[model samples]
Target: MSSFKREFTKLYNDSPANYIKAKRLEKAAELLQASDNRITDIALDCGFNDLANFTKSFRDKYNVTPSNYRLKSR
Candidate 1:
């Protein structure tokens, strides 16, 4: 697992967990912009099991809450 992590980090410049989280968040953002789904549904669809964690993660990445981000995109 460590070897795989090292190789992944070397190739992607980020940890596997971080990479996956980033991809998930990116997908969530795309969904937010392209669909009218509720934020909670989007969060779950993006693999986040808890809404608060999803909100914090999304805010950390985008510098805005999911609802705010969606509003801005519109």
Candidate 2:
């Protein structure tokens, strides 16, 4: 597992966990823009089990909350 993590980080410049989190947030952003789903539901759909954590991660990545992002995107 450590070897795989090293290889993935070396190739992608980010750890596997970071990569997965980014992908999930990316998908959540897409869903926020494209769907009428509620924020909690979207978070769950994007593999975020906890809404608060998801919101924090999303905010950290985008510098805006999910609802704000959706509003701006639309």
Candidate 3:
């Protein structure tokens, strides 16, 4: 498992967990930009079980809240 994780990180330039989290956040950002779905729904749809954590992660990555991102995108 350790070897596989190292190789995955080497190939992807990210740890597996971080990669997945980034993908989820990217999806959430896309949804925020392209759809009118509620923030909670988008967070859940992106595989985030907790809305506050999702918002924090989103903010950390994008430097903005989901709602604000949607507003700016549109």
Candidate 4:
């Protein structure tokens, strides 16, 4: 596994919910920087099971939707 993947997995195992949120946001950040993948695709790839839950968690953590976060960065 990659160093990042291992570190993230460790973080995930140490605190599932916290790491879930963190990993999602990290991948969301990467997607924002790297690609134009849709929010739903990024959410699923980042381990979110549902768009609604992803949106809610993202909003709770970042205070914005994934799209809006990306836009703000741009």
Candidate 5:
């Protein structure tokens, strides 16, 4: 498992879990821009189970809250 982690990180330039989270956030961003889904629903659909955690992760990646991101994209 550790060897796989090392290899994954070396190849992707990011840890496995962090890379997955980044991909999820990218999907969430796409949904925010392309759909009228509620923020909570978007978060859950992207594999974020907790709203607060989702908000924080989204902010960390995009430098904006989900609500603010939706607002800005409109």
Candidate 6:
């Protein structure tokens, strides 16, 4: 593995929770790329059943709503 992969492996291994959190956030971001989907739909698609929890997590990670992130990315 390269330095980047080794560093990430160490960090991810240090905190399994962070690895899962990152995966969920990544999936949510991908779903948010779809302009047609509502935030609730994206949240569910990202394995988050609670829209409120998803919104909170998304905001904490990106400092904005999923809709806002999509709009700005566009």
Whole-model lDDT values for every prediction:
0.98, 0.97, 0.95, 0.80, 0.96, 0.81
lDDT of 2 by residue, 1-74 (tens): 59999899999999999999999999999999999999999999999999999999999999999999999999
Q: List the residue pairs that clash in candidate 1.
A: none
Which candidate do you rate higher for lDDT, 1 or 5? 1
lDDT of 5 by residue, 40-68 (tens): 99999999999999999999999999999
Identify the leading candidate in terms of lDDT: 1
Error of 3 at 35 (Å): 0.9
* TM-score computed on alpha carbons, candidate 1: 0.96
Provide TM-scores for the models: 0.96, 0.96, 0.95, 0.70, 0.94, 0.73
* Candidate 3: RMSD to truth: 0.9
What's model 1's lDDT at 69?
Answer: 97
Q: Residue-wise lDDT of candidate 1 within 9-52, one digit each (tens)?
A: 99999999999999999999999999999999999999999999
The candidate with the higher lDDT, 2 or 6, is 2
Candidate 5 minimal-lDDT segment of 10 residues:
65-74
User: Candidate 4's C-alpha lDDT?
Assistant: 0.80
lDDT rank order: 1, 2, 5, 3, 6, 4
Summarize candidate 6's per-residue lDDT along 2-66 as a digit string, tens digits. Answer: 77667877876745556777789888897777557888887887788898898889999999988
Model 3, runs deviating above 4 Å? none
Q: Which residue pairs show backbone clashes in model 2?
A: none
lDDT, residue 13, candidate 1: 98
The backbone clash count of each candidate, in order, is 0, 0, 0, 0, 0, 0
TM-score of 5: 0.94
Candidate 6, lDDT over the whole model? 0.81
User: Model 1: residues >4 Å from true position, as ranges?
Assistant: none
**Residue 62 alpha-carbon offset, candidate 1, angstroms:** 0.4
